[model samples]
Target chain A: MKELSRRGLLGLGGALGAAALLSACGEASGSASSDSLSTPAKLRVWFMKDSVSDKAQAWLKQEFENKFQGSTLTIEQQEWDGIVPKLQTALASPESTPDIIELGNTQAPTFCAVGALADLSGMKEELGGANLTKSLVELGSFENKMYAAPFYAGSRIVFYRKDMFQKLGLAIPKTIDELTAVATKIQTGNPEKNAHFSGMFLPGISSQSAFAWVFSNGGRLAVQKDGKWEGGLSSPESQKAIAQLQQLWTTGSTTGTITDSTIGSQPYTAFNTGEAGMFFGFNFHLKKIKKELLDAGKVGYFNFPSPKGDAVGNPFAGGSNVAISNNSKARGLAKEALKLIFSKPFQEFFATEGGWVPGNLNYAAALGQDELSKVTIEAVRNSVGTPAAKNWALVESAKVVDDFFVAMGALKDPVGLAKTADAKMTEILNSK
Target chain B: MTVTSTRAKPEGTLPDRTEPAAPRKRRRNPLPYILLLPAVLIVLVDMGYPLLRQITMAFQHFSLEQQFGKPAEFVGLDNFTRVLGDSAFWLTLGRSLAFCLVCAALTMAIGIGGALLLTKLSRPVSVFVQAAMLLAWAMPVLSSLQVFQWIFDSRSGVVDWTLAGLGMQGMAGYNWFSNPLTFFAVAAILVIWMSVPLVVFMVYASVTQIDESMLEASTLDGANGWKQFREITVPTIAPVLLLVTILEIIWDLRVFTQIFILQKNGGITEQTNVLGTYVYQVGLSGGDYGVASATALIMLLITLLLTWRYVTQFLKQGEV
Candidate 1:
């Protein structure tokens, strides 16, 4: 009340200012982001945390710098959490966007559908053509245009303590039931000695690992029919898988409630410390175990086994898809870098250095005769992917599978939770 | 990058009023308005544009498609209706409000108590305490969260070890983030720990500003320490108290970094999500900006409602 004169004056000024601001915003024209710049001086790229091997980074930098002299290439590492929002805002602006980026395969569709990536359909042959990881290429495409090229891929295999297995007179499980039985026997036999020991460290929120259980049992997360997507978790097959996983949780896993990858009760840490007899982890986890454990010849791994006891179980194909940013000024250089990433020398680093199956199948055989690589290759060949729904990224982001598995860990009614979770999955997958 | 708008500039750099002018504008000189040109324009462009954009998006059918320069259709109250109808929204709001209130109350109590203790302490000790509080306040949230994570880590946390040593053997290797209740408890402790310092500093500064002679008069008049504190000290610092309270409420209501970071480590996202994280999940993660904006608008209103009383009191005190 005391400042009415000033307030009135300010209000009048603000009204005029608002009129000016509205017109300014209304005139922000669309930028031509996809145009290739001629000989850009600097290029920026982003790689996810720990996604690329150091050797590959070194090779990529040296080669890119050599190919484009007088141009500087910068590689920034990004983290998985909160990256969607970061990418959404950053990729929308040409000035803010990186020239090249490595996208998580699961998140590729969202950016692809939204036209946040440059169309790479014309460069398919240059990007390894038939040698690309089939599932990733399928995932990174939207409306029949390739936006992201398949990068390296990896699949989870079952890692176990060889010493403990021999001491307990257990065989490498060839069937899903035998796997559970072996785990239960080991945990039951030595409960008094190791109070917090687990036969297998299958955390509840590890949806990537838990995905094996669902896929191996012939259950789909969602299915499409006549331009509509519906939840398949309520199906008998999924329920059976959920039941089997819950049984494993109750009987064989002491780390059932552990949720994340790097947290307490992490599979690698537990296995290295002799707290776990088995764990389902990516192929690289063998190297992550304690050196002493490796020196003791205690570590062994096998492919996730099928129910019929003869073949490898279907694993979730985990990987990244390298793409040039849609807003990048140096698309020509970025395309060269992308092509280089798919080349034999660069692709071989995935197997030789990173412990992953190369994105190019031609180089995947370079891992020739290594025990772990053979298992991973077999697993990758048998891998199943999340449904290629346009909104599947939304489903992953929503954490429906993680929630469902965590509920399972808490010993909730599996059938009911799966049904409820199924509905949520359907809702997110069909939102588009 | 382009500066092509006529509204931002006209004729020359300066407008001429020396010649003929409209009758309404003749009495009022436009010099003050011209003086405010640069600052006002900056504010209009910086804060005004996003505020307007958000308000526009809140009513539109905005999603992935519309994000890429595609035209959005006006959806009226659809987003609001969907958010209101969802039971999860209500649950999350209730939890978030309760969490905010509890955190604010605890922070204020600890802060006020610390301030009182500081007033009674020797100069050196008080300075040391202030320094420690400042350190806690100065620590980056991400680094502090990492420390909290280490402290509550199931496998090797000191809290778990100490609790187990005290004969709660079952607490050994206890997962603090395994369940929702435990997750919130840990998060609340972290939030309160980080927030209490500001309240302490503010209350302490205000208490020191109170006239000592007034307290001496009250003491001589048979007013005990508690009595004078309640009668004189309370009334004198009431403005600062309300101001701090208002700020604390706002900070607590929008608590995001701690909860968001912890969610990435463990706990069910559905169980642990507060309004901030929920909005982020829907808008950015789930790619539904319309619902997220509507949710955020509702959250803004709720915050306003909660802080309205304290804010009005503070403003009134300012006038007096």
Candidate 2:
């Protein structure tokens, strides 16, 4: 037994030595030809999942290679949540930095303010400068200087279980109050046959999204007062909106608060299981839901009702923005790539293949006649981006976003809670 | 009483204790220490450095906003005081202890019982039982947890289906995680299932060392089965049992991935967070490293205090 133990120890020592030697050799080889590698004029591009989906990505990669010829463009796929930290780390070191990047339109103000992005003031004329969405272009600007070009943008639309609603004898709601009454009735009716079936899935974790309802009701999240920003959540208009949402929860929500930011498994599962009747999601959600409900003829899309009973306003626009990174070694090449991205061909590809409303509104009419495409195009036009702020990224990092939603979800008096949230937001905004 | 005659003439320091052995011309052989240097270096670099850095970070107002910069100040003991006073901290600590204790106790009971049963069985049967334990131990925790999550899924889980099949109307398809009792029950069952294999293996390994004659003598003396086990088996495996219990307690306290994944699936993060996941949420997600470090140090202190007695007892048993 002792001999076997000693042999085992010797064998372990040999294995460790071998591993160390192999690693050392690998490191040595990598460093040896480092200087011979053509000065590394490579363009690094980071994009989100569907910002450039498979077809667009393949076409763009091939096109960029053919155009740039001498320079290499490396594309990276990053999830929306991890982009902030990844950018922070990448920006800290010039070597690790990307050349061209995609930013959420809401996130652009902060990045531009911090000077983490390259100012696009010079590239204005080349990037369809005059034709971009005015609000979106303004969002990417700090001190009236553009830092990013408008990329993809889309708005939230109401998707419903059509068959379930029909079975419940519920007509489509045209106003906020009417929507609430219908949701309450459907929740009580439990038309889907599952006791757990809910009329809406307003997850507590998605406070920012839920705030869109308040905004669509002519309630702002914050307002600037004498050079000081004050939160608008405590306003009577916002409270009324929140109260309407809370009434739905009180009548019947899912067993717990569901956050739009997090769907532990898959968000579409709620619809797939016939548990949820309606969800306020972006245009891209149409692609994820359409196939699942197509066979049953169960799913249908509509715009969220406006408080004025006329039409939806400021419907929570979310999408990606294309920008040239300040830290890139291949800035020239990356600028060339951005040109290709904004071109009519690429923008049309975004609409036709990727199911996103291209940043260029002109391409909306070109998306072929399909139900999903038509609805997506309509959602894009009515969408509103988040309020632009210099410290918006910091606010997200402070993790108050989750807390604000959670408090709203659990509050007995949502009006009072919104007041508290406003106070918290002011503190956060003023801290900068 | 007689004064011994010192052969040397000098009174107080006679003969210099056999000439002091001449200081032995010491040869500084550093080979053994050099042989141990890698292990010591590994520990210092891998474990000690990170722990020291964590301690330093606990004293600062470190945040993601200034993640790359120097901390704002060295607010001595302020982070500790703030964390200690937080109500959420106390609640989380209570939950962690309850979870650990329950898991540890259950694992010990099942493990020791299985070991005892194996001892009474034939050789082949015992081997088969041990093989089953090996398979359980080999199964990945995440894989098993994923299976359990599906089985308990509120909508289409098999458990709810079976209940409904039996004509249990209201009870069928219940979301096990919605209620606190069922959440802890499912969590405890998963933890205990994953932990028992190790406890069983350790006890079984130690049990083989016990003499058969002791059990035989106890049986001949007309002791009952329970009495024989109490008199013979329990004492023999007491040290192994203690060791396994201490390990199980530590493992259960730090359980993160299972609960994190389960909460993600089950919609129970607020209700079901333990120390590991809570620290991760605060430090990484919340971007408050100072608070996380304080919380982590508190967890370390707690585990140390809880296991101090068992560790000392195990050491004493080793000496015996």
Candidate 3:
């Protein structure tokens, strides 16, 4: 009898404890509003790695704090990997959510559509008006309501070794086919006689880099038809691009089998080793190039060449979009801080310090009139973006496109793989 | 006082004095119950809440919208039916089971062999081997993953370098992670390597505790080493072996870090996903919390079923 009563009491205690905890969780979720514009509330902002330069970060903090007396703004750096899941959980609660978050441009539509971000339709004109990057603005909107603002934009460009070109008596490639021919010639020539040399340091896992070929050939990753999204990899233009990319993998590059994204991002590593004659990378990667190579005038840049040589190829627009979480307690204060972020100094810092095309094109003049800047601005101008579908982030997280290209890089049967990948993409894109 | 006297024995003995003590015992002291309250509360709050939430979510249509304050509609068996109907889930299940069995078997074989060898080694050599195994076991998973990635790297990996130097010129830049077979091979190697030390230590400790007299008795009966082992050591350590095997099966079946980190490096994520990563992909990455919860529940049932017989036998032995 005693044992039974004790067990019952223990069960009752557990039930009471669980009930109390659940009620506590429920109570904390009731959001507190910003009492006044100048109220001293500490704001937390999350920025992705490598997105904001240290100088820009410090300046933003200092400027925001100076403007809003007694209120502290704390900036936390976040990694790009696994950030989607992190945001999904973090943005659900008032206490856990950062006041502002910088998500990848491709991921903005997901957050925007799900109501995780605060609607910024009223402040759109005040932020950048029509001067904001159009594609980014489109990606950061859902049902005509703006949720995120363009942070900055950049695109890949061909960075080749001028010494290698001069040594081999090769002219700058003017078209897609010409680029391939040049790469093949360099690979066969092996001017440095390095056994591990590759004409182009293109890794298969760098699906964003390969997007240049697809977009240049007038193909998209996905397209909406009759209000239903369909995968575009099996289209004629995409197939042709894949064939050309496979040709490059077979004859001009030995880095196609590389599946590591970290290695994919660092194309200049092989270039620095004097083994890679050329690499496709961001203008920001210029800072990462060997100083000796730059001083010797061996480094040169070019926009990705088009197939017909009529225009620059459309590389993927790589950038971020900043948004305030809807769950943020201090929405008004966050808006004020966001105004400082879009100010002239902060916008110009993107060009002068970070080597990215600023989110606002108005401050692009600070990038200087150098050839490198011209190519970078031109690349960003012609750049394409991933599908703005609401579930595009899910597709990316699933890595369907990345896996398909990795197989293509391995010289697999592209036709079958493209069919499978297209089906997967379509299924994911149309899924709720 | 009359009621107490009626409850007690009427004999003029110690029983007459214990009647007062019996009433004292019935007074119900609250100290023990109070002492248990905090522990009970902690367990309920920490583990019980998440479990309750997961079970409830399995029957709901939960997604990112629902996660962000939207109403989640209860879908009854929809999530279960969807997960069970998917071919991908079945494929992942088969792959996970195969990977788990292979890894567990290999780890057990190598661990048991090493433990037996330890019994034969000198004290200093045994101590050195134990220390090395301890270090390997204690090394962080992330640090080991980084080293493994470098070793298997396509461009400058030592594996490719060594293979190329051995006249296998075709392997000079062979990408280990590009192929699914080789990807799982690397993952399985890592899983077994990380887990073998624990198994070795456990088996060794138990093996040393076996009675030496029984082994000598078997040997005097003209029994060979293998025969003595099968007759004496096997039965003596059967319970420990069973427990370790069950633990290995569970650990390997739910192996996450090695496969997940390798899949990130490798491009064959879909082909290489085990059950642990599959749940993560479907729930966290894919944002289908309902279906993921259902799949996780199914995985739990399968694990329970797999270990049910052994667990029962373990309990029976404990009772004995």
Q: Local distance difference test, per candidate?
A: 0.80, 0.69, 0.86
- Residue-level lDDT of model 1, residues B229-251, one tens digit each, is 89988899898888778777877
TM-score of chain B of each: 0.89, 0.87, 0.89
> Which of the two, 1 or 2, has more TM-score?
1
Candidate 3: lDDT of B170?
A: 86
Model 1, span A1-432: residue lDDT tens: 334443333333323322322232221113664444356557788999867888888898889888878777888999876677778667766777888998888888878888778899999987788978889999899988999888878888999888888889999998888888999998987633787788888888777787787889898888897888888888887787888788888898877778654643356877776788999888777778999989988889999988888778998878888898877777878887888888888888888888778778889887768788788888988988888778887887787877777778767887787778888987887776
Ranking by TM-score: 3, 1, 2
lDDT of 3 by residue, B70-158 (tens): 78899999999999999999999999999999999999999998998999999999999999999999999999999999998877799
User: How well does chain A score by TM in each candidate?
Assistant: 0.91, 0.86, 0.93
Indicate whether candidate 1 or candidate 3 has the larger TM-score. 3
Give model 1's docking category.
acceptable
Residue-level lDDT of model 3, residues A34-105, one tens digit each, is 636867889999999888899999999999888889999999999887888778778878878899999899
Q: Model 1: how far is A342 from its true place, Å? A: 1.7
lDDT of 1: 0.80
Choose the strongest candidate by TM-score: 3
Q: For residues A1-432, what per-residue lDDT tens digits would candidate 2 score against the true structure?
A: 333333333223222222221111110010111212234466778888667877787778888877756766778898876466556556534566677888888678767765666778888777776777777788888898898888877777778888878888988888877887777788888875786677776666666557667877777777778978787878888777777777767775663354324462245567667777887776566667757586778888877778877875557777777787665556656777888888888888877777677777677566678776676666667766556766566556544545555556654566665676677568656643
